[model samples]
Target: MITKEDRERVAGWFAGRLPKQWQSAPAEITIDREEITVRLTIPDVDLPKDASDAARAEARVGRAKAFREETRKQRMEIAREAEHRYDAKVSWGLALGDHTELWTHIAAPVMTRLRQPQRMVLDTLVDAGVARSRADALAWCVRLVGQHEDDWLVELREAMASVADVRAKGPATR
Candidate 1:
């Protein structure tokens, strides 16, 4: 992907960017036209062996490799959990349509699993003019057919916080 002249030109450019303290640093660059990428690498070098006594110094590259694998595993697990929770929330909300369906499907399950305040919050969203209807509240607050989880969650949190502030201003009337 590179000619000898291209390599020399890039290396010259890189050498100028190095610090004064790094006078001995190696300058290397590779350009791949097909990928539209330029990779620059600085070669690692060890100090000269002293008269005291030494064989050769080797890198613990495997340790760095293992550390990368561990970070990857943690990231994958977190992503999987988020996706599963979002899927279940969307499926549950879809089963709820009207009163008859809600009573049979949504009410018992929510009452069993969710805390009182959480259930009340969902109910309040439906009662307010913020949402078009019960299904709209579900679609807006959580994941369902029409909405994205991240954006809808942001809007829902803002609306809920505003509702709390309004309630604090008003009387204790239910």
Candidate 2:
């Protein structure tokens, strides 16, 4: 189980290890059981006041691609070290202006057992073309729930973390 301290330590490590020139601000680090994603907000592209939306978007994409190619070696080395230390794969991304791009992130498969009613729900989504398969339908459903209940989920997570802290302070089990 990952604790809040573990997450903070990983973020702090990346902040100190990353080159100062790579990002204008501290990297945004997100960690789960299988992967750690580090996103950096780089300096924005400067354009004329009358620049069109297409020009701005093109510039952002160009900048992101160039940055990815230029920093490939350094990023790989950092990822290798991080992966070893954290026992998880490392994915990287960059944010420029309003555009963000993530690459090489894990899509770990999940396993679950559902009754007929639950299975029907997934089947309905697939039949309606909302998802390509049961797996996709399940993923869509989870994303929908997350979007709708984000605040409640956050509160629940906080409560769970408090429980973990309390458990840690209790007597050791045999």
Candidate 3:
């Protein structure tokens, strides 16, 4: 376990090298086996709050690229120090804003009642080495379908929206 003092010292080392605008941003230090990872997140200010979700995502991509270029030298210095001090592999990645909209976090758990045959198919996928377990196989299958049928998925979502709109209009009175 990393001591509080050590974590603080590591955080301070990187914090001083960060941009003045990001001086107060939080630092997360994690140690695993023989490597230490230090992550510093900065808010992406390029996109307005009112920007569309796609626009925000695109802006985040641009901001990450720009930040890496801007901080390359300082980050390399911190990396060298971390390696020399701890004798461990050190690397870092940046996150934009609160990171709520990252692709992995965007997925919500879906609970569905499946027929016995469907359940068996998921189990078979695990047995065949297609996935680690039934849940993992189900996730893999969903991802496969999503990747191969994005246009169909979009149409399905539009249809669902239309159904909801019609339902919200209420039934015709006799």
**Which predicted model would earn the best lDDT?**
2
For model 2, what is the C-alpha lDDT against the true structure? Answer: 0.94
Of models 1 and 2, which has the larger TM-score?
2
Clashing pairs in 3: none
Residue-level lDDT of model 2, residues 20-119, one tens digit each, is 9999888999888999999999999999989999999999999999999999999999999999999999999999999999989988999999999999
| lDDT ranking, best first | 2, 3, 1
Off by over 4 Å in 3: 16-24, 100-174
TM-score, per-candidate, Cα-based: 0.20, 0.93, 0.51
- Taking the tens digit of each residue's C-alpha lDDT, what string does model 1 give over 1-174? 244454455446445543333232352332333211112122223335462222222222332233335444543453244335322111110010111111111221221355777667667887787676555665566554335466776576567656766766788985
| Model 1 segments more than 4 A misplaced | 23-25, 34-174
Kindly give the stretch of ten consecutive residues in candidate 1 with the minimal lDDT sum: 91-100
Alpha-carbon RMSD, candidate 2:
1.4
Between candidates 2 and 3, which one is better according to TM-score?
Answer: 2
Q: Which stretches of candidate 2 lie over 4 Å from their true place?
A: none
- So what's the TM-score on candidate 3? 0.51
Over the stretch 61-173, how does candidate 3's per-residue lDDT look in tens digits?
Answer: 77777767887787777778778977767767667764422211123456788899999999999999999987888999999999999999878766765666666578876
Models ranked on TM-score:
2, 3, 1
Candidate 1, position 68, lDDT: 33
